[model samples]
Target chain A: MKRFAFFPGCLIPARYPAMEFAIRQVLPRLGIEIVDLEGSSCCPDPIYFKSKDKLSWLAVAARNLSLAEDLGLDVVTNCSGCTATLSEAIHLLEDDILKKKVNDRLGRIGREYKGTTRVRHIATVVRDEVGYERVRESVVRPLEGLKVAIHYGCHLLKPSKIMQVDNPDNPQVMERLVEALGATAIRHRNWYLCCGKACQTEDIPMNMMHDLLTTVKAAETDILGMICPTCFSQFDYGQMKISKKFDEVFDIPPVYYFQLLAFAQGIPYEKLGFDSQRFKPECLLRF
Target chain B: MPEDADRDEPVRVNFRFRRELAQKIEGNLASFCYQCGACVGDCPATTYSSGFNPREIMLKVLYGLEDELLGSESVLWQCTNCYNCHERCPQEVKPVEVIISLKNMLAARGIYPEVVSKIIGTFETTGRTVRITSAIDRQRAKFGLPPLPPVPMDEVRILLEPDTGTDEEE
Candidate 1:
């Protein structure tokens, strides 16, 4: 089995642990081992981009990268924000002058960054390593009856073009994966919309009422399968908001790809963290 | 507005691209904005909240609010950069271009928040963006879990870093 350093970023371990757990149990069956790294700080996310000093933001990310490279492990990122930030830094640190400045700062702690490691989001791993056809073959209890909508969050594909794992405007990696699970892939207009998650901190009400609502209206589906935690929250928790405001009950559930894979593998609902999700298992079994 | 511009001194803001920007990112598409209010008309970023306006900011470029626009937080940070304005623009005057240009300007001028400062400091020290810890190292502690099999970090580095390393000489 091939192994790599796994990074679930700040959100997964605490908020969306289920996605992490599902990925762990399912990937090993495909010969991929995920090594969890501790002492990792917040990827600093988008908030870092707002920083007054680029050098400082670079330093924080650099230290984290150094920790992995020093240990001689490649980074597997789950959070798009972390991947984007880290990917951008890969360019900044490669330059000789900026490299010297960044290193001088970390030199205080005996931390040296050689820029030897790489980062991969989970979706890329599924698409690249576990080819869609292989996944199709691995289906123990294929998702033969379920209709799935693929929501590729912006962070995974935004200023994110350079390190993109798949298409930017019309992505199908998730859809192909859904097909591999033996499920009916449902197409939705809002799948292209941004979850509007990052803006919540900046404009709480507008981000929800306008940005999020707009996407939900376009979703028009039974289940929303997402690759991101922030995106998942927009649909998972955001569903409650839609139900509160609208007339007819709007109850499109949110599911992780790993969960679906685990479910199809006959892994019990408990192991797949079914109880931890906002959408209940019983509610979904109707499909 | 055209007649007013003819009579009144036309206010113009000078925008310069930064060194760090990709010369080809379509970030320069702001040059296509013909002062159409379409971006102002549909932009949630412009009107979603107060003191943050992409259209008004575009007007600032026309009206020459250079220092203020570059120095303002709302213009750059407040925008979700979802490219909604770009998608909705009637004249194809991508407001996103101006936003990117403005952001690049701020980054070059070292006008961003303090966190950027700390991160740049980190980059000078180490070359990578994150740190990873092996899950199997701890046995007695609560963080301890079933020992994970050995992980391969080399391939992951290749995927994320994507030729950022110096392997050409080898």
Candidate 2:
């Protein structure tokens, strides 16, 4: 079994322990050993923190990367935002000039970035490291006949050169993972757009979520699958907010891909955090 | 036109686009953009708000319109950092990186969105953007997971603040 230092970032532990629960339960079964990353700060949020302070962003990320490097394990994260921040930092710091500048900052903390480690999102880790065939063999409850529409959170797939996860335009990694669980992965209109979580300003995130949920509801999707916790919260919870704001009913349960995977692998229902889910995932129990 | 002369201040294109912005992002990918408008065509932000266009921003960057770019209030924030434009751009100019560089410039001047400041402040203090609530703690305990490890705040502060030694050298 391959081992990794799990970087859950700020969201999962703070907002959604259920994602952590699902990840912990599922990754081990797939033959990937997960270790806790102590003393890690936020991926510090790529769009917000990087926008506000570039030097601090690089230094913070380099520190986290070095933590995993010290452990001699590559980093694996469930949050797409963390994946984006750390991976982009790693890619950016490759430049000798920027590396020197960030290292100058790191020197104050007495740490250095050797850039030896690699960062992978949990979904990518599962698909690449565990292999989809092994995932298929492990599924006890094939999510047969369930139609899942994937929100491939922008961070996981974009700036294709840096992320290198899949074809950015025609992404099939999440769909393949969904299929391995015996669900039919369906495509929706707004599948590729940002969850608008980055636009933390006024009505934009709500407006964007409204558009995405409306489109997915129209497409007759059973569940919205996401690899990012922020996207999970946005759609899973944002739909309710959007419904109240627009005065329309939207009852789509947004399930994190790992939660769905754990469920399909028959890791009990209660552990999946279904009750806390805004749209109760009781429907999936029928399968 | 002559009657409105008092209302229109002289168009000052004095602000040159910082070549440093281009260098910071992908090492000169911004200069390779030939203004194909592919990024504009794929941009969702541009679709919703017609005022925000990635192609136009790139043109401004190419033309050294730093004043024009920074003067665009909330226009830079309109980009969701989706990277759709980055993916679609044939020239591989990751416009999102340039957008961020612009935001960093504005942030350095204390001119970013209020929400960004609030979130960053939360990170600076708490090490996480979201505060740990009793409800979150209860949830973790119920799930049988150990409490979250204490944030390395001393190290976080050192990283967030400018290095004193570097400043002294400067």
When only the first chain is scored, the TM-scores of the models are: 0.88, 0.96
- Note the DockQ of each predicted structure: 0.12, 0.62
Q: After superposition, which runs of candidate 2 have C-alpha atoms over 4 Å from their true positions? A: A201-203, B1-29, B63-67, B163-170
What C-alpha lDDT, on a 0 to 100 scale, does residue A187 get in candidate 1? 61
Candidate 1's residue-wise lDDT over A246-278, tens digit each? 543656678877888877766776566666557
What are the per-residue Cα lDDT tens digits for candidate 2 across A213-283? 88899989888888888788788777788899999989988888888998998988876778988888787
Worst 10 residues of 2 chain B by lDDT: B11-20
lDDT of candidate 2 over B1-170, digit per residue (tens): 12233665764332334544643444246678898899988787887776789998877776566666777374788887788887888887888877887787777667877778888888888888887777788889877878777788999898887655543112
TM-score for each prediction? 0.70, 0.92
Taking the true A–B contacts (Cα pairs closer than 8 Å), what share appears in each candidate?
0.10, 0.72
Regions of candidate 1 where Cα sits further than 4 Å from its true position: A48-52, A200-220, A245-248, A281-287, B1-78, B83-170
- TM-score: model 1 vs. ground truth: 0.70
What does each candidate score in C-alpha RMSD? 8.3, 3.3
